[model samples]
Target: MFLEVGGNRSTRRKPTVTRENMQTHQRDREMLIWSNPGVEPTTSLLGSQSSNHLATMQSVMYELMSELNDRSEDLERQMLSLEQRVEQLTAGFNALPAHLSATLSAQHAALVHLLRERDSRDYHRAAGGGGASDAGAVVAVVPLSPASPLTHIPSLQLLRYKLPLLRKRPPQCQL
Candidate 1:
């Protein structure tokens, strides 16, 4: 039998329909499973594109993770700083009343000492000079002994101690 060459009606030399030739024709028409430079890029192109997509996704995930870790660390630092500030404020609040009490107690003691010194001076001047002229004058005695009960007693106890013993007359007001 003869075969048409190039779809021209001209018949070429008689050709043999061999089994190997038929298999080669079928192979050309079917899909190729392997890579070939002559064929369009199908499987290789898809595989490479998928690999690129996976790499991009991994980079994005890494960036997100890094950002999250940084934010968490920043929050932890802020929490620690806030806790320290709270502690300082609490300590200051707790100490304020005690500090005020001590300061007031010291002032009261100093005032009581001054009053005693003034009375002692007035009494001596009155007995020596005369009463009316000595009434306005004031004096001070420094460095009372540590062993003195007058120096060591609490203000409440000192106020209760008999001031009449040191003065000629009684005070107008009493605790």
Candidate 2:
């Protein structure tokens, strides 16, 4: 009789099966079909699915990179605005008269002297001088004054310790 393997296709007709041999013959045929080594059918479909997944992942990564770049630009703009505000404040303060600047400087010097004296008195009782009293007692508050000695400028020290940004600004004053 015709055999239906898996689909509508049929093989050549054979003798009718006897009841005793039917089970044994079917088993033998099944074993022969299973033992034959052949390519799996699903490989092409699985490979295509993997490629699609990789493309989707790459698209997501590109979108995140673009977002990060946008945020970086925003931060740069904010930093520039802050710098401009600080420069405006400095200029306004510098425009004060020389007499006023000198008065402010002298007041700051007096405050520094008082603070240093107070600190020394407090620490003297605890540490008992220990021979380093002279060094520790000198509270150096270098006032950011426009009139105080040019040699006393703290920004001069910062020039050596600086990155490239400060060096690029036009020097309005020589000192």
Q: Name the top lDDT candidate.
A: 1
Off by over 4 Å in 1: 1-48, 128-175
Poorest 10 consecutive residues of model 2 by lDDT?
A: 166-175
TM-score, one value per model:
0.47, 0.32
lDDT of 1 by residue, 83-134 (tens): 9999999999877766655654555446555565566676687686545222
For residues 32-144, could you state the per-residue lDDT of candidate 2 as single tens digits?
A: 55664352325545667878998998999999999999999999999999999999988877676565667655654564454445456656776875543432234355665
Candidate 1, which ten residues in sequence have the lowest lDDT sum? 132-141
